[model samples]
Target: MSAIKVNQIRAKLRQLFEAHLDLSDIGPTDGERENKILSRCLAALAIYIQTGCTEKEAAESVWDGGDDNGIDAAYFDPSDLRVVLVQSKWINKGAGEPEAKDIGAFTKGVRDIIEQDNTGFRAGLHAKFSDIALRLSSPGTSVHLVLVSTGASVLAKHGTSVLTTLLKDLNGDDPEPIASSEAMGLAEVYSGLANDPLLSNVSVDATMLDWSYVATPFPAYFGVIDGLQLKTWWKTHGKALVASNIRHSLGSTEVNNEIKQTATSTPEKFWYFNNGITLVSNEALKAPVGAASRAAGVFSFRGASIVNGAQTVSSLAKVDDDNRLAEVRVPLRVILLKSAPAGFGDEVTRTNNLQNRVEPRDFVAQDPEQRRLRQEMAIEGVDYQFVRSEDSMATATSCELIEVTTALACAAGEPNLAVQLKTGIGRFFVDLSKPPYKAVFNAGVSGARAFNAVVVHREIERWIDKKKTSMTKKSGPAWGALVHGNRVLSAAVFAKYGSGNLSQAIASFGAAFDPAVIEAHCDIVHAKMAAGIEANYPGKFLAVLFKNPSMSKNVFDLACA
Candidate 1:
């Protein structure tokens, strides 16, 4: 049975990634080497599953070539500052774990990366060495080693010990461990590939203390519930609990991490700190599980969907200590929609999420200057959306506040603004009354100016995408830097070629800017930036360099020159 499942997973993997696999560089191969190729493909699949990167990205992550280290594939997740290293074994019989020697080799490869040594790695790995090294060296950056195999079981005792010892040594006295490992066998691989279907109707049982009901508008219940119950729902149904949410749980974000830490360490204060979970359900009934009391009573919900507090529930689910979870209390509200007006559920979901976290850009929508710009852009037959809405999807004729801010940042000819964008766009929107925000969107800025900058910025992005596709193996380093320094390059192009008289230029150039001119400027800017980095910041990570204001300014200056 296990062999059948393994074969099925193998077939599915090939179907999904066969077009993405490139073995041209791997020397001549025969039937005997089929397992090796499959193993490499499995490594790519592991990357795709673990990192949520695209198939092409996963396939490109493979470094299994000549002079290859034991590491088969790797990905650097910028969101949480973590690196995922994968080693895969394809066993046709579906019976054996990775040998102890394999674990040793994998650990050594990890150590080599930790030591910043890429002397004996493959060309592809060496191409990415600097950026990976920089990411690994960053504080709070963690390493996750994944062992994927088409076997029925995980690593043997000896193999597990070898990997564990390596993680322990690397983690040492750090309060937050720097290294972790997971082994995915045949069953795990199959489940991941299958993309386990979400439960359609989630029924939850809760003990609501100090519960009260509203008889008017609609049937509603509000009370405090144990965090353990919420955790159980998350454990049983996962994303199914929040199927109706406006957004899924954003994994491992700083805010979510804080929530997790608080729940695990200081559960008693969770009720006061959290906004709590809201559920909209088809039906809710007080269960006669035991003698009813106002202090606590069991309630059952049918077709329940979490409309808000997805992050809170997910964080609670991560709490490993049940005792801590038992002490955690959360305010929960369940609204029954049987007699509610049509679309009220959606309105409930939307409004509930809106009041949770207000982004900096949200404040920009209230600015009179932004309103003026929107009206001005409307006169020119373009839609300028100052307000943020979950339902507003991007259209060719429309530009959102975020995109306009980015374009304005580039057009300002300030490398620091571009660096701020690269680091985090929230920095620009932090204070509308401040230098950065006011500097970009004040009275001097006209709708034509903003629109023109956006046009040019988008053109530059398209050119970069095309150039990346056309790059050859020999130009891999240049390609890497170009991608990493895209914002800085855009700033440089605008600084060098953007019109000084914005309103006049728009009147003359109109919406139809010359693609040839834009592409030419992009070519010059990319070449200059690449050359500058190579000459001045040798062995430096392009990502780190682009985020540094001083380095970015110097590179931008060189590019414009």
Candidate 2:
């Protein structure tokens, strides 16, 4: 059977209630097919909700229905025991809204149904709203009612007075939530976590994945086939999925690349990447990257934030409206650990309560694991734990706190031992895992700096050990979306488990990635690369692949594209 509960039914009913003025025939389909649908829906909702998904995370939200004892289905919010109720009815195409008396009858029927269902399933329901007169006396019933329908909920145009009267009623309105740097909502929480590229698995076991149903920032991408068929499909079809020309946060400001004999005094060397840019004053002959930064003793990642003195502020969020964040510099020292439960947003939002953005500085840096038995491995009915793929991810987010602590320690270059701080979110709560890491781990970054120059790809492989691989599979930004991130971006991998696979996969493609495509990509590079490099095989590192600084795209072809 389905897991749909009375409240979920309530939420579904709520939508129908609001969509139309009446909701009698629109709900509880009497035909065998509709009845089976209702029954299966009820079972599926019940089973999945019990699977550990918060009501909202279960994607069980519906509110177009009315309040009163008429709740059809709904889910509850853990942070606050806010319950959503629903009243739903299936309608065929071209059907009109039910009559006020029918709505009144169903509305009346739901109250009785609640009493009957309540006696068995949720003991709380029987106690909460089984009796109409009792619930009406408790609140205005405005706070609890939801009506759902497949079509319109226009109970009014049909000249229905009762449900219309209910529609006119309210405990009044509350402020609509706004998501800023400070506050978040139920849906935002899951969406934000889903946006994270670092996440790998969410189920109790490692194999089950929580991938996106739609296109998201850190895409939950997968392949249904293998090899050339896959690669062919990927190149032909998948490329559309990948944004080909992202407005690079870093770009060349040069008006044109043209410079004739008259303009050439002595073309000087240039260096640029995600970071800022740099160019030698001389206009003579130019040189390669090895002749530039490595010689100058500087290496950096895609730029964080850099601005002209005129911009006037360091943290752009404070100075500019909208934060002017696209392309602003960010230090690798900064790490964000966001967590939230599932099932808050049945429609517009998600579980984990968009409230995932707790202050980074708020949590005390402690390994949640090391604390030992502060909390249990969840004690709810195990069957009630199944969650939507998106909502199911909260379990793994537990690693954030400790991982951030490790990243900060590495960044600070402080002793490897533990240090603590009282954070803004909760005072005594501590972190427990060590998925810790550092961004700018070496000295080369602080020395050489850039002002402005032609932007190019960052030499990330130079810093991280690009030759190694990882035993674990994961995903996220900076994470390979196809297979788990085995080929990470750097070599200085660090984890509590140690002997880290973190940096090993630097620039390494994913499991679904075809070596032929890689070889072809290399062929493109072979023509423009530093030269003398040919056959690529047997764990060839990205660092050695384009090792030469002299690589350049053909001018004519570059223009055509």
RMSD of each: 9.3, 30.1
Predicted candidate 2 versus true structure: per-residue lDDT over 1-561, tens digit per residue? 112223334345233223322224345554454443442243223312222233233333322223333344544322112233444444333234434555565445333332222322244443433343233222112123433333343545543455444333221121111000111112222233233212222111001112111233311212111112112222222112111111111101111111111012221211011111111110112123443332221122121111111011111212222222222321111101121123211211122123333322233224233222112212210111111123332222122333323233322322121111100111112221222212221222110111000000112221222321331321111112111111111111211112222222212212222334333332232232212122222222222111111211121122112
Off by over 4 Å in 1: 1-86, 90-145, 149-181, 184-209, 213-221, 226-248, 252-308, 315-330, 334-364, 377-400, 420-439, 503-505, 508-521, 536-554, 557-561
Error of 1 at 393 (Å): 9.9
Candidate 2 Cα errors over 4 Å, as ranges:
1-69, 79-81, 105-144, 153-164, 172-561
Candidate 1: residue pairs that collide:
none
Model 1 local distance difference test score: 0.78
Could you give candidate 1's per-residue lDDT for residues 169-271 as a string of tens digits? 7765444466899998887788778773233377888898888888897889999998888899988877667778866665554466677888888888888
TM-score of 1: 0.56
TM per candidate comes to: 0.56, 0.22
Give the Cα lDDT of each candidate.
Answer: 0.78, 0.24
